[model samples]
Target: MKKDQLYREDYFTCPIYFMDKPEWVKKLNKASDLYIKKAQKNNQPNIKERTKKFGNKGDHGMVHHSTSLINDPKFIDLQEWILATAYNLLDEQGFDLKGYQLFLTEMWVQEFSHLGGGHHTLHTHWNGHMSGFYFLKGSERTSCPVFEDPRPGRQMNLLPEKDKSKVSLATSQIHYKVKPGRLIFFNSYMPHLYTVDNGYEPFRFIHWNIQAIPKGVLNINKE
Candidate 1:
C-alpha cells in the first residue's frame, strides 16, 4: 500500500522588492553630490579635528548624512513613484488600506566614509510601514545591507543549519549586494543594517520610510 504524503504550509513570510533603474543613476547622483558636500562642509570643524586625531585618514570612519530630501525638487519624481508603489505593495500583501493614506514620513541620503569602517547597527524603523534604500554608488568591495530574522521565537530556538550558505528555513540572516541605481524595499519592522566598509569603492545611498496614516488622523492634505 502507498503511504499518504504530508503537507506543508508557509506562513508569516517576509517580502523584499528591488528595482534596477540605471537611467536615473547619473541624475540623482549629481543632485545628491551637492548635499553631500554641504553636509561635510557643515561638519568641517569636527571633521578637521577627527582628521587631526586620526592622522590624515581619508574619511575612513565617518558617514555623511544629508538633510531631508522630502522637499527637494530634484527627487520629486522618484518620490512620487516610490510612494505610489509602496501603497500598491501593501495592497498586494492583503492590507486593508481603504481608510488610510500612505505618506512619505522621512527621506535622506547618506554616504559612508571612503577608506572603510563605515557601518550601522541593526535596527528597525518602528514609525513606518515601509522602508527602502536607493543606492547611488556602491559595489562588491563596499559595504552592503544585512537583514536579521524578525521572529523572536525562531531566534530563541535556533538549530544548526545543514548548509548555512543556502537560503532555507533554517537561515536567520540575509545580505544584499548593491550597485548604483539599485533600489530595495521591505517592511519597516525588519531589522537591517550595513556591514563594515573596506573602502575599496564609493558607498552612497538614499534611505526613506513611508507610513500609512488613517484619514481621520490626518488633518491637512498632501501637496
Candidate 2:
C-alpha cells in the first residue's frame, strides 16, 4: 500500500503590520489636529473637494498634502521601523531588495468627524507601488477598511456552496476592524474603501505611499 500527501497553495496574499507604540500614536494625532487648526485658520482647501471625482463623502473631512511625517523627529523611530518592515515584506515575497532603496513618495493625514454617515468609495493609489494606513484613533465601532479582490474573471465562474463543512471560499472582499496603533499595508493596485463610521468618536488615520528604486538614481528637470 502507498500513501500520498496533499498540499494546498495560497497566492496573492496581502500583508498587514500592527504597531504598538502608544507615544507615537499620540504624537500623530496631535500633529494632525494642529495642522487642521492651522489650515482652517488660513482657509486651506479641503482635499475632499479635489477628490470629489473619487467618491469621498464624509461629514467633516480634511486632508493635508505632502506632510512628510517621516522626517519629523517625533516619528523618526516609527518611520525607520516602517521602512525595515517594507524591506522585509519584499524579501518575504521573493524580491531581493538588497541593492534597492525604499523611499516614501507621499505622506498625508485624513481626519474625519462622523456624526452619522461617512465613507470613502473604492479607489486605488495611482503611480504608487505600495500604500498603507496607520490608525491614530480608532475603536470597535469605527469604520473598517475593505479590500476587494484584484483578480480578473473571478465573477465569470460562480460556484455553489455545496460543502458547509469546509471554509467558505466565496468571499471576494475582506474588511479589517479599526484599532488604535494598528497599521495595514497592501499593494497600491488593490481597490479599497472606507466604510461608514458608526462610533461617536472621531476617526483619524495617516496614509502613506512608498516606492523602491535602484540606488543612486537621479532625475534632471527640463528647462
Best by TM-score: 1
lDDT of 2 by residue, 54-82 (tens): 65544344332334566876666767777
Off by over 4 Å in 1: 1-4, 51-58, 220-223
Whole-model alpha-carbon lDDT for candidate 2: 0.69
TM-score of each: 0.93, 0.75
Query: In candidate 2, which residue pairs get closer than 3 Å at backbone N, Cα or C atoms, i.e. clash?
Result: none
**Per-residue lDDT of model 1, residues 1-223, tens digit only:** 3579777899999998998987999999999999899877766777788778877665667888999999799999999999999999999999999999998999999998876888999999997899999999999999999999999888999998999899999999999989998999999999998999988988999999999999977755542
lDDT value, residue 142 of candidate 2: 77
Report lDDT per candidate.
Answer: 0.91, 0.69
Q: What is the total number of backbone clashes in candidate 1? A: 0
Worst 10 residues of 1 by lDDT: 214-223
Q: What lDDT, from 0 to 1, does candidate 1 have?
A: 0.91
How does residue 38 of candidate 2 score in lDDT?
A: 57
